[model samples]
Target: MKKIPETMKALVAYGPGEYKLVTDFPTPDCGPDDIIIKTEGCGICAGDLKCQLGAARFWGDDIQPAYVEPPFIPGHEFLGTVVDKGENVTEYEIGDRLTADQIVPCGECEYCRTGRYWLCEPHNVFGFKNFLNGGMAEYVRYPKTAVLHRVPKGMPLLDALLVEPYGCSKHAVDRAEITNEDFVVISGAGSLGLGMIAYARMKNPAKLVALDILPERLEKAAEFGADVVMNPKGTDVAQKVLEMTGGYGCDVYIEATGHPSSVLQGLKMIRKQGRFIEFSVFAGETSADWSIIGDGKELELRGSQLSPYCFPFVIEHIMNGDLKTAGVVSKTFPLDEWEAAFDCATGKYGDFKIAITF
Candidate 1:
């Protein structure tokens, strides 16, 4: 274990397109049931990039307050070493490798009582609000209420940072309920979608399809295990999917494109009574024909939120080599090169999952 610092550098997000690199931020205090973690690495999630682009959905309008209360550290997907633990804690030891789910629920809510705490009315997500500040800092305190996972000690930080994203994918896949005979189509090849590709393939779907506007991402999707990858920029993706499904449409469709057009596009590619999993955090509101969901096709539309009840599966899959994060985690940067890291992640250099290593 390393000596705890009194103050450390951290990146704070004040609002849309506004940030300050703070070098004198006080180290978080560990509560009786909390543990202090030295951040190893943190990845830039799609939602984080959307915030930098000034998306109204995350930043909010004059009528509504932003989901993220300004001035909080903003990296949600992270891994760390358990540097110190409080007296009440026995699950983690100093120098242990670990990560936590992005949210902490009250546990007294009805949703938590039913084992669905992911949607608890008073739950706090790591990055969205200041009360539950995220992992972009050098050190963070993991409260006992957080859903924590003990990762293997020797796992690479790049791969460990992926657990959060893969856990989200697991929830989406659970909502989709794909089987060996179902034809599945995932409408995004970004990091989250790529993880979905790996998990969906493990389910042995009859036909696994990946669609994206970027040829590079589509190629990576194929490499990650999508049976087929398509670039929608110059093709009628819905028509192609329907034709591939013998004019019926795919049995399951998961939308992670983070684009407004993807919702309706997925609607056109899923068959009657098919399951639709929507997980992307869009920058703006998305509207679709309500009739298509019920009257038109009677599709099963499910909205999957944060990672819940899936961390173990993701950790195991990654550890056993069933799920790989080779090309997915594109690059790593030291904490000082924050802007360059964001630039690379936002496609300045190229679209890749960029992480900041401490």
Candidate 2:
């Protein structure tokens, strides 16, 4: 086996929207139960973008930039090959393909014991709040549990980079009980929303309504099997969705915009006794008029944090070609152009998922 480098390159964030490519950082050490992955592909997630700015809440306000220091890597969705493993790392060998979930939970936590580890308190997501060198770097180390599962055989590593977000979308759809005949509306054509669009197609919904402010994103949404794409900027989304669903509203609504107004729109677009699953994490409080759901409308509102037993399900779908994982990605960038990748991922240039290839 070849010797590993002592230092490697990575995209470091000092504060909101601030980042620089650094190549001299020390490679993180691998523990007895840990593995070091040589990243092949990384997906710039919305949450990671938000984390670049002070708006991100993954780490409490107390651990702001001043506390974390510079040279902090911020990538969570990624796929790679194992290059080195500690003595006890038996599940993976050198050159094995793998993808990792961002969150690492304490097995002793109440949420972990209850099988809701994704929502465990003090949950530290790699590249986000608690500060772990994430996949944006040339290499990252983590425990076996954080390494969700092996990549599908014969699947491209680039497509595998998408599994993380797709898992999150699956949880939302599954929690809402989406079905073949259900009319589903997804608010936000961002990467997360696009993942929802792709996975929702597997269920063959009666109609899929995609809402976004950008035409470019909506255009892509159509390609991903969205039945009708609506730009809510100048349209009455609630009325349009209602009319599209025969005045009954949609059976399921997934809010991925992380905007309070979008959440309200989701609440209004659900049919009485329907389900609204919030896929976005809107930090801070915003007023929500409960009167719409208070009058015995029998609405079910859910807050889906991340995938819970949905990772393997998404992997199977992608492997079987039931879900269009590759279609969801619109562009790719070399790891050196981390700034450009981050910008494109945040919809600064346009709408579409931006992937980083090493």
Candidate 3:
């Protein structure tokens, strides 16, 4: 008689302000439309912190009893290797290095048909409610609809984990229409903010000003190609941006901070016809006064959600050395110490992105 396999280690959220390492879980089995992957590395995002803090109502705050329930893994930004493939799947085979976009949109929805797939009603997330199992474990399963892109040869696994966030920033930069002659302002020097600074630098923006509250993060942003870094604590952010641009408001503004006031302040930093792109992913409601956007200033306001057209570009940059991430990755932790890693990222202990390696 054959014996049944049992047990694997995973980082699970026990409740608000608590995450415990669990080991009595079954390793995932492949389904007809699924492929199993061995996690290489995964990034800790600020949004993940919000989810852990009971702000995860998007998936229902209550812990339900089911195969998919709380005490579930909580990592969405991941990169891994395909270890097993289920029947009828031909796009990928065993041994492929891939990473997935967090949400797997339902392809039949009108929003998907119209290219706004991020709004798909019945969305699935690997690290959150829908999938319930994420890459924080030894393995993860990818459904047919997930946007799994192949990692190029020689690409660092740590940097691969950054693909999702980099894709998002690239999308925002595209929407802002940054140009060689345009002066651009990036609000927030977080991981996503630094990525925008890197992507915008590639387009040769006349000036790339990065605004943030932390001095360490600002210094890191400057190292990542920001023309100037400003700490809003001592200087008026809007005034500094205008002065740097010779009295003309910046030509483009990219807001990566979900803070309402940042978005409102962004409005005052852009030129009459400039573009403003909002790229922050917050779990709760974010509101800003509309009067700044009401007078037909001919300004353009765009919202860049999960990236739909940036994975390939991100890969290209990594391959060509244009998007060096050596400095972007500051620390790494093993699977067992995930709680400590999450705490560091949530507490803003460093100037770079935090990652977990298995």
Candidate 4:
């Protein structure tokens, strides 16, 4: 192994829309219980794009407090090889392939005490906080509190990059509690939405539908799992869903599109007692008729956060060829070309997952 460098290349976020690449950024130090990884690659996510564009949930507003602490690193969907380990770290060693959960829990919070660490009050997600810098750099440090998992030696880079998103997708599908008799609809055929379609298909729902504005993504959704695909540009999605289900609407609707209109569409296309699972991070607040959720229909609404205990399942499936990852990652860019990478991720050039290779 090469000697640890005093400085390394990194992308730091000083504020919303203010990320810069610095070649001389100081490399993170390893604590007694920490481990350092030489990053292989990191995937650019929609949430990262929203944060870059000044999402209220990330930058904060008069109504909600900010979740992000600027002057931080900002890539969470990542994987790498272990290059250094602290004195107290024993479960892993140098040269091991590894990844960690996006959020690091306090372990003493009320939520953590009950095994619901994803809801830890402080909510210190990697890439958003200064202490927990993310994997958009040449290296990353995993603290003692991180939930670490090892990647198989033979796993492909594309399949490895998808574990994080697919884990979240599995969690969202679990929140829906799909049954064999239910008719499910997932709005959005992006990477995360396509993962949801694959996981939902495992439930053997009566009918699985995917909705998207992009025909290409809809086609990928079909290849992944969706039995029916609909484009809202030329069709009234709500009426079409109603017509297909004898005017009762779909039994389950998962909102993966960050657009506000998808929320309204879900409310209109879900049945009276249907379940709705929301997993997207929006750039701003969304408004809707409260009556639609209460008086109009006693619908069940559930919001899913990060992947909690689903990483293991995702890794196992990916290694076993159960999850499809072909064509999911549309492009890859070197760290020096971060600007173009962001543009491609935000749909300037294409509509698929974009990754930054180390």
The best candidate in terms of lDDT: 4
Candidate 4 C-alpha lDDT tens digits along 1-358: 8888989999999998899999999999988999999999999999898888888889888998888987998999999998888999889989999988899898999999999999999889889998899989999999998889999989988889999999999999999999999999999989999889988988999999999998899899999989999999889999999999999999999999988999999999999989999999887778999898888989999999899999999999878867788899888899999988999998655468899998
List the lowest-lDDT window of 10 residues for candidate 3: 59-68
Alpha-carbon RMSD, each predicted model: 1.5, 2.7, 3.6, 0.9
Cα lDDT tens digits, model 2, 1-358, are 8888999988877666667788897887888888888888888887776667656364346543232444478778887888899999777788888877778787778988898888778676777542476788888887756835788658887678778888888787778788888999999988778878888887888888899999888988898889999989989999998888788899999889988989888887889988888778665556887877768568888878777777787888888877776556778898888777777787867747788989
Q: What is the lDDT of residue 355 in candidate 3?
A: 88
TM-score per candidate: 0.96, 0.90, 0.89, 0.98
Of the candidates shown, which would achieve the greatest TM-score relative to the real structure?
Answer: 4
Name the runs in model 2 displaced over 4 angstroms. 56-71, 129-131, 283-285
Q: After superposition, how far is residue 44 of candidate 1 from its true place, in Å?
A: 0.6
Write one digit per residue (lDDT tens) for candidate 3, span 1-358: 1222456778877666677787876778778888888889888887777777666443453553222356678888888888887797899978889888777888888888898777777666778752547878888878878878999747877778779889888888888888899988899888888888888889998888999888888888888899888887888989878777777798888888777778877887888888888888665666766756757457788888777768999988977878756667678899888878877886467646888998
As a whole number from 0 to 100, the lDDT of residue 1 in candidate 2 is 80
| Model 2 clashing-pair count | 2
What are the lDDT figures for the candidates, one per model?
0.87, 0.79, 0.79, 0.91
Q: Pairing residues by index, what is the TM-score of model 4?
A: 0.98
Residue 49, candidate 1: Cα error in Å is 1.5
Model 4, poorest ten-residue lDDT window?
Answer: 346-355
Q: Using alpha carbons, what is the TM-score of model 1?
A: 0.96
Give one digit per residue, the lDDT tens place, for model 1 in 1-358.
4578899999888877787789998898888899888999999988888987888777778866667787788888997888888999987788888888888888999999999889988767787677677888899888888888898987777789899999998889888989999999999888889899999889999999999888889888899899999888898999999998889999999999878889988998889999988999887778989899999999998999989989998998898999878878899888788888888887555476888899
